[model samples]
Target: MKVSFLIDNALREAVVNSCIGILLKAMDIECKLDNYNFFYSPSGFDFFDRTRENIDLTLFPSYNVNRTPEQLSRAIRTNSMMVATHAEQIINSALYKEKLNTSAKSKYSKQITSHFVWGPFFAELLMTHSSIPADKIYITGNPKLQVSTRLNTSTPNLSPSKSVLIVSDFSLGDMDDERWSQFKKRYKANYNTPIHRHYYEARRKLVNWVLTASERYPNIHFKMRIHPGEDRAAYELLKGTNNISLVGDRDFIEDVLDSGLVFSYSSTSLFEVLVMDKQVFNLDLHDLPEERKGEYFELFEWVNKSQFMDILRNYDEGKVFYPSSGRKKLLEKYMYGGNQKAVLRNAIAIKDVLENRIAQYGFSDFLVHYRNLCLSLVKDKAVKAGIWFNKELGLQNYISTLANRRKEADLNNPVRLNPNKIESAYKIASGIVTESEIEILKNNLYEIRKEKDGIYIDF
Candidate 1:
């Protein structure tokens, strides 16, 4: 059977979904997955349409950026079935809502015959907001379940008791609570203006917390693994600490499997950690929204205050909380709708809905178990063509340019924006903003007004 998958962009979060495409091929279905930015303009539709036919199925996960299932469905004329996951991730952002609404208005919404949601929350949200039917809801566990590759990477040689893993919180570049507060006072006293966005907002402070926890507890060593899409600067800053080690590799499930405990700040990684049935901990910070506050607090048996001393004092001896034995049954009811391999199950379900009999299928015929293989092999040429980018290029400034490459390749460099270099480049340009070098740029420079002839560098 022929199948294709589209993830729009290759951000770390989206790459996590590549397992579905891989699994399809393993089941002996032909598949193609690519990072095509289908939302740029109308002309972009052809790239997606060309791969639609002569295939048994199409999987479109990670469409959070701009494209909608409706838009792509109408462009492709295929008798092959279509199955989509992560339907809820699309509307979770304020930015995506605008794009989704626009696409829905243009007749794209009506064309999508089948789409699966992340969980009950998203399933309910979509039905309430759109004309979609109830049968469309399928609790397909994410392909991330297949993320056990890391577990295989380390085996009898690695002792789980000797290692502990900490997955840091999700962060916006401008959302540092401490940095934003300081920037506000500095801005108001000097410019008499209030700062709107948080400045110095990387996950740097959490590294300190990690160090403190490590120092306090000597029994189990600590390993730090930041989100894959995150830049190297966040990890580099922590490198100076003697005790902590950085794991920047892309594999997620395997890394967690090798470790005994995981500490996260409201990351979806918690789901995978639970899937592994390992001890999980949650850290509390101040920048997140209220409703989201402590949402995952109940999930972990372990919880800690944000204060360094308090965490250091209590963390080592703290006991981890586990969801009840019945918890998995409860979560699976809403999360997986009984089928853990939701993508595969959803395709089978779709075939059942369209036809009648349900036949057994497998990915072995189409996909080879090159378990030792790296995705870079299949993705390298595309990376050169604008698919994936690495954070290793510039350690100091990885946050600024780590994943920005339209395609994945090593040749790309961060467009340097040093103050002196900018001044020279702008002096010769026609309408550039290099008026003065002595400028106090806020986090969100575009939001600030120029009092004098100060130059604004929009990043």
Candidate 2:
């Protein structure tokens, strides 16, 4: 049996999925997994020399599959049993009404064999809104948050020195056409303000506050981890302060765990810190719409720039107040099982499906797999030929036009992963998991394999 995890965002999902990959491998399943970019993108053919045609099961990166037609069409065309496993777990009523409704009512959702959700909240949304069968909804916690407990204890995640980490969650940035269209509608409805103006206005204020704070406290180091959606170059001017460093490419989980103090404008990542019983601030520089506050308001300490500065001053002086004891209950209420063995739960669910797997027309699928393998070789050759011709011959103007024919920019997610990285992540996660679970996989550690044979792909 073959399974493919079509990852949407590599940085966020890859590590946790690595945990899942190992579990599936232990089940004696041949798993093909990577960023959906490499699995579906035109340039992806470069890294892949063979394809596993007609996969037994394909787990898409997010439930928002309707947002990307190209990927959706390709996924439907290629896979046998499709599962909608979400990467984005933070869902509010407004967000669900605006974004997820399209996915819920989508034909793709109807075709999906299983719909995996982060919590009961998401499961209820799919059940109520999509009218999907109750049996189909799998309430798996967000994959990343699943491994949070193990990752939290990973000593390397702890900082060597005290540093302040400001998670910048600005709203304006590159978006898919569907989301962009929605943003336009929201912009029109809100009289020219962006869809999430509160995030924009507040994060902007927080940025200025940090710039001044970084100077005022030169001895303290501050790292502004910019939002993945926001353009990093937009904050180039803020990089002048030596005490503050604007970053985009580091591991957010590790950084969050390492930081002495953590703050964000409106990101849900702060909850990961809260899980470790650490203090994190949600800087509400601008008043957030009551509807947009969502369930996290009770778990996180919502404060403004000035209030944050006062807290920071206290933090620097070695005094800080942690989140309330009641936050544990709120976290549990919102996070379903509140950080249980989600990776194991996901692995077990996929395993059960595979164990009772239906027989596909075996011979035809064998032929199809080989055919796809051959076609992958052809695609790889063609991609290499194009690259050689463009770079070697210096024919940019012509190649640019051909490249524009493919959605290269859209396929190019900010973070990319390779087998070595995935393997390394697998090893790291293996170490962090419980000893008994490690014993289960110890015999099969070498069994973990991927569909394609490339180190990495750069689109």
Candidate 3:
């Protein structure tokens, strides 16, 4: 049987798919993995070329859910299966609530053949709220967590540089006028809150706070890692300062592992740092209304400038900054479950679906498929025209060049895993994949290699 996994985003999806691919190949299963630019790809790419390939199953990360599932269902043969994995372990509280409410009224479960989740928390969340059947919701854990844990243990021990790392998320300042206007419209419609404005105000306040804190502690070097796809020029002010530095084109996990202290305004990295037992502080500088505050923030220690300064001073004096017992418990319960065999479990679940061990859900009704077909036809034409126009104007080449540059930046910040630990994890998970195959898979997963048609996974 042949299985294909789609690579939507390089940094996030590649590692999980690589592990799955190796495991499948080791089990005498054929697997194909490739990258696709979600925005530029034709709407019916999944359907148009389905007949050319003999794929029995396709595994996709969460981003593919934006479009109707008919795109896959109508394209593939009736017997083929489609599986989805949650992109992140923790679903944002607001989005979670929205899903729960909508699931109560709609049968959105028909959207996919099978759904793989992080743990009991997510599985339970879906079972109780979503229309997806409990049996179909397999708790495979998160394969990415396994990689993160392995990387954390394998990382080299370096002398403490007494550096504090600040991680940034997207803000209004990061967007151009046109993009900001579109974002404002979408944010207002979906959230019913002024997220764009609030984010701008909060980010500005937070940046000011960091500058002030940096001035107070001149000895401790402060580094800000701007979020990917953000405009680095927005942070040009930090360039002139000696103590403050903007560290771009670096892996976030590597930064988290290396830093003496990590700070963010409720980023997912907080959970990652906590899992590694690192000192992480949350800067609650985003001045959102009480109702708009996400529940995820409660997991971190919120500190203002004065409290942050105190923590830095204590850390500089060789004092250990311990989180509250409550925060530690929260981290243990939600994020880190001490399981490093997620990849193996994920592979086994895929195998089960492929072998008919797990019951599969059916596709959407004919009316829905017809609607999708009509919408896809229009979209496909628009995309073709856009591509033709871009090529005529040399915009296609320029865009491709920019993408290659970004891919190169990602390749430089490679994740080095402990070879011995990787074998151990594979053995523990009963993975039959050979060590050499796993190594080759890891090397090619994060880098983009060009093909005659487009960029493809070398592995």
| lDDT of all predictions | 0.43, 0.63, 0.60
Could you tell me the TM-score of candidate 3?
Answer: 0.73
Better of 1 and 2 by lDDT: 2
Candidate 2: C-alpha lDDT: 0.63
lDDT of 1 by residue, 1-459 (tens): 665555432323233333333333343545455332331111211333453455455555533212333324322434444454552242233222432343352232333445555455555555555544555445444434423323333333256355667786444443355654664343222222222221123255566677666677665567787654445675665576555778745345546766656776656566666655665666653354332333333444445455434544444455443445664454453354332434344333333334531212223211221221222233333333332233333233332233333323311312212233233322322121112211212111222112121111111
TM-score of 2: 0.78
- Which residue segments of model 2 deviate by more than 4 Å? 38-52, 63-66, 97-99, 102-106, 156-158, 173-193, 357-414, 438-459
Query: Who is ahead in lDDT, 1 or 3?
Result: 3
- Residues 1-459, candidate 3: write the lDDT tens digits: 888776555544555566677777776788765443323242223344443566677776652333344535443443446676766556555455343334322434554566777656666666665655665666665666666666667675353677788988755556555676675444322445555566666677777877887787788888898876676766776778888888745446667666788888757767667766677888867666655455566686788877887888887777765556677677645532443556666666676678764323444445555666676566556666655556676566444444445445544432322233334333433432347544543343323233222221222
Query: What's the TM-score of every candidate structure?
Result: 0.57, 0.78, 0.73
Against the true structure, whose TM-score is highest?
A: 2
Indicate whether candidate 2 or candidate 3 has the larger lDDT. 2
lDDT of 2 at 17: 76
Model 1: what TM-score?
0.57
User: Which 10-residue window in model 2 sums to the lowest lDDT?
Assistant: 450-459
Q: Which structure among the candidates has the greatest lDDT?
A: 2
